[model samples]
Target chain A: MLRIAASGDWTIAHLSAADGELRSLTAGPVKAGRAVIDFSGIARFDTSSAAVLERTARLLEEKGLRVEFEGVSEPQRRLLDKIDTYGTPDTSKAPPAPFYIELVERIGVTTREIGEEARGMLGFIGTVVSAIGRTAANPRRFRLVPFVHHMEKSGFDALPLVCLLTFLIGAVVAQQGAVQLRQFGAEVFTVNLIAIIFLREVGLLLTAIIVAGRSGSAFTAEIGSMKMREEIDAMRALGLDPMEMLVIPRVAALTVTLPLLTFIADLMGLLGGGVVVFFMLDMSPGVYMSRVQEAVDFWTIAVGLIKAPFMAAVIALVGCRAGLSVTGSAESVGAMTTRSVVRSIFLVIILDALFAMFFTAVGI
Target chain B: MAQKGEPIIEVEGLMTRFGDHVIHEDLDLTVNRGEVIGIVGGSGTGKSVLLRTILGLKKPDAGRIRVFGIDLAELPEEERRLHERRWGVLFQDGALFSALTIAENIQVPYREHLHLSQELMDELAAIKIAMVGLRPTAASLYPSELSGGMRKRAGLARALALDPEILFLDEPTAGLDPIGAAAFDDLINELKEALGLTVFLVTHDLDTLHATCDRIAVLAEKHVILVGTIDDMLRSDHPWIHEYFHGPRARAALAGK
Candidate 1:
């Protein structure tokens, strides 16, 4: 038998220094059929290093040597026995897949996920539409208090923020348009440019984006947390239709509020354009208002207003769908909230582009 | 073995209050090394508050707490951290980081405190997962994927990651079934014997106390009213103490023991 003296502090704090020596002992040429590890001089031991020692013995035994511990203290022996009886550690993690294979796998997964998401969203929209229709037919089924509360929260509270953002955007458009048009001595047309853009596109799209971020995110978070806490299930257990109780009020409020907010945004945007034209192009408010009045007909404003409720419906539907899909984790609530905002904004922009194309084709 | 009277934790005249509401006042308790001490109390008695106070998680209103013969409040920040590594705490919920896997959770303390290599840490994490009665496959799972009992076991494995000298458990067996709770009690007993760990357990599980505790400390009237073995508890004349030990649940626990 070959003897190995395993001594000193066999604890976590000292294990790093002893690691190489212990490994060399295990890997060195074995002159004898058996090896005895003497532990009489060990001043301290702990579970951390007991794991290391147990591993070292296993390695030695696997190398065709009979490994035995000798002269361990009572406590050390008990620890060793405990570690020995515990199952072995799994040291090998499977290797990752190759890059091209993983890339193909990811593309397939993403495509499937997008398809499922589209199907789920369409189903949710149908459910919300039916609920709205039911409440419309039977007016008493419409919850008055919650509808009023939601209008106040998702509509009235959003007024100042929406007005301020659209005003800034309108000012920027006036300033940039004046600078560009001045190159051709057409700076006087800045008012006409601002009027058409704000009424036809900017007012409606900007308000939709803001509300999607603000109220839409709130809707997803509220319902997602409710789902997480099992409150949604409780509502069903109490024979309440969550669609009517929660979804209809919030969606109807958004649909009503988005148009009103868009109208206010249109006014604030024109006021901002008037102010910028007065300072930058030396045009008075009267001249600016007259130019804006002659820029387009009722079609300019009607085009933007016509898209408001559709955008509202899409945003509300996306938010509620994300909320209802939340699983039993706090992390899922955050992830779904983000998804709601992003998807709503993306869908709103796509709908705006499609509306613009249709109106141009029909000579609006 | 540690000497009979070697105290690892000593709390004297510890007072804790939340604004005007006093949770504990003039409380005192001593926990000897290498023994399991169970703290029991009524609903509002603040058994967990005492544990938190000793662990320095909550500031005491007025008192001194000494752990390992040194007052933690008097130690400088760096030295306090060194002492802090000697003890570990398991909260009522697993409280595992939701983002990390079970193996990564167990390696958190090791990565923070030790200079071990990745392979060594992985091996250690696997051992801890198995030691806590978790299957090897659970190493890759997130805490949210685990059942309540499994989460508690994973929490225990994380607590033992650094080979702490003292383990503090707050209601370790609270949500587990009876069989799971009894197995947990046996695991604690076996771990204490093998590693010579000093345990500070705060729980209402009478069966756990009967199976694992070296002594029981009863908290009442904002102080430790009694501290002794179960027999000493059965002989006490204090009204709350009498009711607690002679209760039907206590009789069943004692009979089972």
Candidate 2:
């Protein structure tokens, strides 16, 4: 048995047997009357290569020589069918026609147009920002009625969940702090741990996250649906600034309501931690209350209060920005609502961390 | 018939692009006072974009959009808002606030722009709701409780709250049953005649187009290819134009004749 291993660059020229030497080499061993073609070494095969193989098979049959084919890859088999269909001398040259070039071009043009639109949107953002700035400058002109409605929705309606989550978080924190403080024979310090953290960070953080998930998502969905319905356009047609009439009121409401909610959450959380301190640490209610009062200073409360407006601003901005970014259909409203919640919570946490750093650096 | 005064809206070379997709390019159109022009087009052909650009909600990339003789692009944000009060737009969805009662929705624009007393605002809201044919009892109900037709009517009432000179309706009769749509068309016609409002209506419903519009502007092939009467459109030799106005679907729709 004659074994033949053939491997080379499977270019069109090589596959086509364009060179007399390569053709003779493929034909010579077969003509000598014993050969097994090993195709495993062949990395690439084209129509021309398949045609050469078919031609060699015919020549071997004519010479009364039995030839065995080996290592025929799937791609090679597919090429063989293509060669047979086209009656392959394989003169077709030039790269296989690009299927996606038109799609790519269309996508490119679309991307450029979208980029321009985004740039224009930047200008609109400036307008929105300035409008917000003006409203901030003239708080009286920004009516309180809409803001009052927003507060009822964002704050009052969200109270049950805020209270529940803060209570649970307070219990968890106090329990965890007691475990560590007891190791240091400072079990009484659990009151300070729970009180200080609850007043300074955890209470405000939990409240903001809840509001971001609840109110922020609500704002995005509401405005996003309005956008989808062209209600925003209708407002514009009626000579109303969507920012002033819609977003400003929402932002203002969140700004005012978040601080109040945070204060509420802080109070509730401290009460919850007092429960844990009283039971787990064997401290009396009066003693826990006195310890918390001594441990948490006004500055700690102020630091948390300061972070509330910032968190509120983040929630409002992310909600409105995501809502404003929505285009096309109802699906986009849902998508942006989710995006608004995620971005608001992320920004709130980041802002909280920064506030923590600032307070710590200033030794406040 | 156009009067000899300046057009109420003059949109010159208006071009709007969303990302790489060009929705409208070099679009020039005019809306005169007291003329109801219907904008008819296939889906995604930018009929809504033109109305939105005119309203200054979607800014045109390269165009001069002037409404009520003021260049919207040149006006400051506050001034643009002042200019906007001159027009009214009824969205297709009748986007009433779900939380507010019908009366409160009508009071929104008024309360935002005016300093009227609560009783006076309530009175004005009642009048507007009555104009839309809703009973006084309907005023206290939220939008979620109202029927589709009633919501559309309430939305119309809210649009008319400012007493705008120009009115725009986006698919006012869409999704409504035949009788409801006809009733809406009748309401639009009555409102148009009573107010002498310059109306720009965007619609796909052929019956609404034939019954209500003074003239129809067909958007095709990335342009407003034709703007004429139904008779003029029927006479045109353009293939798509013919297919649109006199096609099998259209013929079947009008087959009762």
Candidate 3:
């Protein structure tokens, strides 16, 4: 006789232990044909156990044994009938390709997608440039109201946050510099370190990141929703230029406002550094100002200032492009808005690095 | 045959109001066992609200609802769950959980209400998927991947997971094409016969009423105005009822009759 051992409370509560006992049977030997599984010692068994029973029977059959139960309850027998009808899941569609081959295929697909995105961004840039030219040719057609509105939003609204953040960054830089320089009796040079660093890179880069997070995402969401509602198409149908009416004012405002915001951020950073110097090293404000004036070069300020328009262009273009790419779904609007902020901030840091390398190479 | 036993669901003096707006007042309904009752209404006639109140998803200002002869307010929490487990509801828009696959969606009620293993649950889900006429491969696909009709079928499969005696459908044919709607009607009729279920279908589709419902309940003003066969709906003299049954869509639907 083929022996079948069934034990424990055969339910979902005891599934792990029951399945364990069932798995152990696979490792050992069993004869082919008929087997009686005893459920006399089983305390309780439910539908979950019926599934285990079915699986156990299938496994036993694979080992060339036919299985039957000795003492199944009425309910369990009915549930067993259900399990017998459903059979097993078919995993036929699973790809049998090698792992490395699939990995390479995925990489290829992603690279092509990135290439298409880059091409689309380039096309948007060309359209924006032509739109800018058209605005320049007919200056009176420029919308002053919306331009001012955007400036107030992207610039004036950002003042308090930008000021507060830059102040803290500036303080950390001055404190760190003073700690290192004071060791060599050159604590006075902390002013030069703060001025050069903030003017050339830190203040402007931080501001760009903040603006990308705040204003860039807003631009994407605005334009994306308009596209989703078919308002952009409506504008086009009514002989309105979306580039001039929507894109131009926003881009123009960002371009003009970013430099002003950067200049203010630089001043705040200097003030923060001075406060840190005063408290930590007993450095006087008078001495700090003279040092800053001495170390502050026109090229340093011009470098950061010149980069502002380019950074603004990057934010506006990426934001608008992401918006324009939105299809019919509201989900697309959300995705594009997030992409707009992430891409703008990422490109800003990269462009800043390029500027640093170029300035150093040219010995500016 | 429908009136052979006591009503499975009974609603008496049901009143629903939102702030100053009254959606329903003194509404009464009796649904017998093993019958499909179609609810019809104009826009803002609170057909969905009545379904919600009956399902206990929404609380009315004042009412008495008896499902399976138990007062819902008096039933204890565990007992209430037991009663709830005996019924199933399909909402409009096929509210399938976005994260789970179609099969997994069907398995949810089973996982919660039954003591079944992962294998059994998976097998049962696959069975439900096929029962709803979806391809076996569709068991692994997410709700977002399915078309509108497939989504509704998946939702129906999930509703049928627990082998519920009572099925609640909200506008089941609203978004489907004419052919798909007819097929859905046939599926409902088949399932009702095969399972001996009492179906409460809130619908505006006149064709569906002719095809599937054993009785039509017309809601007007604030309460059920009429409850009878399609022939009785034709004989009703109420202005709203007269215009609705004699409307172009209704005439076209009755063309086959």
In model 1, residue pairs whose N, Cα or C atoms come closer than 3 Å (at least 3 residues apart or on different chains), thus clashing, are: none
Model 3 alpha-carbon drift over 4 Å, by segment: A1-99, A133-146, A225-246, A284-286, A327-334, B1-5, B71-83, B111-115
Better of 1 and 3 by lDDT: 1
True contacts kept of each: 0.76, 0.00, 0.08
Tens digit of lDDT per residue, candidate 1, span A149-187? Answer: 988998899999998999999999999999999999988
Interface RMSD of each: 1.7, 38.3, 7.2
lDDT by residue for model 3 over A34-136, one digit each (tens)? 9888877677555446656777788788888877788876655665665566675453446679999999999999999999998988998999899889989
Listed in order, each prediction's TM-score against the native is 0.97, 0.46, 0.81
Model 1: per-residue Cα lDDT over B1-257, one tens digit each: 34645999999999999999999899999999989999999988999888888989899999899999899988999999999988988889888988999999998988888888887888889988888889999999999999999999999999998888999999999999999999999999988998889999999999999899999999999999999998999999999989989999999999887
lDDT (C-alpha) at residue A70 in model 3: 82
Candidate lDDT scores, in order, read 0.90, 0.79, 0.86
Q: In candidate 1, which residue ranges exceed 4 Å CA deviation?
A: A27-29, B1-4
lDDT of 1: 0.90
Positional deviation of residue B72's Cα in model 3 after best superposition, in angstroms: 4.1
